[model samples]
Target: MELLKKNIHMNRQKSQAVMQVTLEEDFNVPDSKADVGSIIQDEAGVKIEDMKVANGQVMVTGAMEVEVLYVADNKERKVHRLTERLPFEEQINMEGAETGDNVQLKWDIEDLSVSLINSRKLSTRALLTFSAAVEEIYDVSAAVEIHGDGEISSLSKNLDMLQLTVQKKDILRIKDEITLASNKPNIQEVLWKSIQLRGTDIRILDGQLDVKGEFFIFVLYAGDDENGTMQWVETALPFAGTVDCSGCSPSMVDDVELSVASVSLEPRPDYDGEERILALEIVLDLDIKLYEEDKVEILEDVYSPAKELKPVTMQQVYESLVMKNFAKCRSSERVRMENNQPRMLQICHSRGDVKIDDTQVVENGLKVEGAVFADILYITSDDTLPFALMHGVVPFSHVIEVPGIDGTCRYSLKTQLEQLSTTMIDSEELEVKVGINLNALVVRVHKEDCIVDMEEAQLDMKKLAELPGIVGYIVQPGDSLWSIAKQYYTTPDRICRLNNLESEDVQAGNKLIIMKTVEITD
Candidate 1:
């Protein structure tokens, strides 16, 4: 007789690779632009054009857009904007990769530097990091129940499997006509504009996802004033979007990411010159990942009462995205000088970069250590009105107390600068503070054992007649009713009824009477 067995199927697939590269480029100023004097603001955006896999390697082709706002060296102190697009192609080693695999890539600028080469040329350098994750879907038909004349013993555990329900990409466009305040100047030349996604609120209902978020728009514009002075203004834009995810349930987990692909800005046509109005257009890329959890009982081991059975067992480990945590870390650093310290006049621009140094998984959560680098440009306390640059580094450490995390889990951490500011503490000192956000996604791999197949073994039929129908047995350590009944060729229900036991749990050193039944095969 064949033993009846059950099996469980895993629900998730995940793999990741990370690599870093330094990018450098030399760009000439536009034909009509003046030479660069001091760089004010620098921004970069990355777009993946194509990706493919062959011979255990992943080929990635993408472009990085770099925009710099700088002051000209002319007598007028003109402000100019220069933009360039640089393409890159690289191969990353990914074991077991093949064609048509689903791959997602994320690009990050870790550090950047802009140097003035001449009045009409500039050099740009940046340290970039690319991370890619590939997930493959598998459909496994698990056996739920066994059908045969044999006894089946199994071990099982509950798993919150991550089942991919929906994967889709869409474009979200934001159009708005914003009017400047009465005290501000009219838009002459738009120097630079940056968009930051501050927060997101999501709701899932009836296979649909509703998304709402806040976008902060910072614009630096040169006024129509006689001196052509430049100033910066900020505004908030509220946006809403929807995603269709059919066959998805409300109990499932959702992971959504939004990125700015491109942006366009123009002065409104009906500008009255009193309250300056500008038209803003922004394109956003959206991605949705949904996961559904399932529980299944797997048959681990089996045996037969009338024969000796050899069961084939197999074990495998699977990985899944467990949870993502969003947190903010704030730190401040002070730069001091004893003498000849440049006094602060006004800060032109300020930005920061944060790097994750280490992550230690403890009993409850993770202890994260990192450092923040701040760059500030200011019209300093010096002659000839030269722009002075100051840099500061601050070290930070934070404890993320998330419960239920163990040694078997791994995590990925990403940090971004939210805001940076500087305050002059005295004529010889300045305080720099930065606010950064950390997004940590945890992934877990679990192991399970399953009984694949079984074989029948020979048994002694003459010994069955000499065995007693009822016997007294003493419970030993780690003894259970199922184990005792399976050994005596009886069921747990019959053993409980015969002994008049209140429950299936029995203590050690207890005496119980067992009734046995022997099965005969044809």
Candidate 2:
């Protein structure tokens, strides 16, 4: 018996393995240094320099930079700064990983320890953690076809699918000089400086991407005075440019990550004294990935009328990567800066950095918990030490509003401090107001049903012979017109016409008349 057939073929990319691995490392200090001191404040910065893949493994190389400010042994304790750089190497075992695959790495400082070895030496231990993921992308194909002799019926559905197109890396640099205000003091030494991104907007053009944003540059400098007083200044540098991305369009979605690679500072040429002009050099790295949004038609279920048919089916529940924009949130905190150094002081300069420690998805939003590390330089109430600095940590929690979020969703969130300012409420309490923005890409998992295969079903001749020519039968559970027609060697349309029925929906315990017209052929 010849059968009708329909065939379809398409190419798809599937991720074979998505794995995460963590690594740790440690280092020590040398002699001739101050021993056993109380750590006033410390901060650690981690970055992944490069990644390479070899036989069955991925090699990651990176560095961790740590800065510590502490009080050493003296008649009166004073804050002293110490800095160190630790290099690390780790290998994540991926059984089928090879060159030309995609690997992502992020590192963090898990633990840090400091202890005294002797009067002149100290021992330091640090635990560093690195997480890496190796994704194997391969081609996948599926074809749906109908194979039968009689009329066939089927169902279809539409689905939104995400396809990754390009992944690349590039460098962007900013080299220019900025002049300090006339009222501010000259820069003798920089205590703390932070470069933050703000009000970033991106657009797509012909063969390129347009990026426009402003850099919030904040600097706390020690003035060249008799007591080396501290003061702070801030400026916003607006920048606009384009990056070449061949065959890019506005319809596609892109993810761009910007990071500071290196930074340098120098005194402006031919300028001296309080009329301060400083030169700055900053190098930033950009990682961009493009994705195409597509809608696909899928075949769900099928049936045949004249011929006995058996259709094969398969079900798959998959995650679609979706980019979502969350509403900006503002939080306020009050820090009490009183620690026996001075009391009831006047604030000179204040700056802080916000770090997100944890994130949890909630109903139509995200909950984040982190701390703000701030250093405030102030004028003491007494006349002994006019300029002094105090360090404090203020913890905060905020909920970012985003729609269509649930517990099963996986996401990667990027957070930034939009605005930070401080006001003196009292001699002991400082009122700090902070604004934040949380951008998220939520990967939602959706389930769909599909029909994969179909074949002609064979019937028994002995069962057909035992059936009466005209009979009355009662429909039972799980009964269909297609099945009953195939049993009596008739078509569903002919049965419906003979039984005076409008449709093929048969209910259980319903009485029906059956006529079997089978010419017995030997």
Candidates' TM-scores? 0.85, 0.73
Q: Kindly report which residue stretches of model 2 are placed more than 4 angstroms away from their true locations once superposed.
A: 1-42, 54-57, 68-82, 92-98, 110-127, 134-137, 144-150, 184-192, 221-232, 270-275, 306-317, 321-323, 344-358, 369-404, 447-522
Give lDDT tens digits, candidate 1, residues 1-522. 444444334534456788888889998998888878877567788878888887678898888889887767777666688988888998888776778766667778867777888878888888889877766666543334455665544434455555566666667777887788778778788887767665566677787777787776767788888866666777778888766768767787666666778788886545344437878887877766666666555554454554666666566665566676878878888976435446667765555667778899987777889887765656666543444556678888887766767898866665666666788776556788877777776767777555566666676565655556799999999998878877776666677888898898898998889876675444
Off by over 4 Å in 1: 1-14, 150-160, 271-275, 319-328, 335-343, 377-389, 412-422, 426-429, 433-443, 460-471, 488-490, 519-522
Which 10-residue span in candidate 1 carries the lowest summed lDDT?
2-11
Query: For each predicted model, how many residue pairs clash, with residues at least 3 apart or on different chains?
Result: 1, 0
| Candidate 1 lDDT for residue 514 | 88
Q: What is the per-residue lDDT of model 2 for residues 36-97, given as tens digits with 9 covering 90 to 100? A: 35554455676677789877687877767766555556543433456677676777776666
Q: Once all C-alphas are superposed, what RMSD does model 2 give against the true structure?
A: 5.8
Error of 1 at 335 (Å): 4.5
Candidate with top TM-score is 1
Query: Against the true structure, whose lDDT is highest?
Result: 1
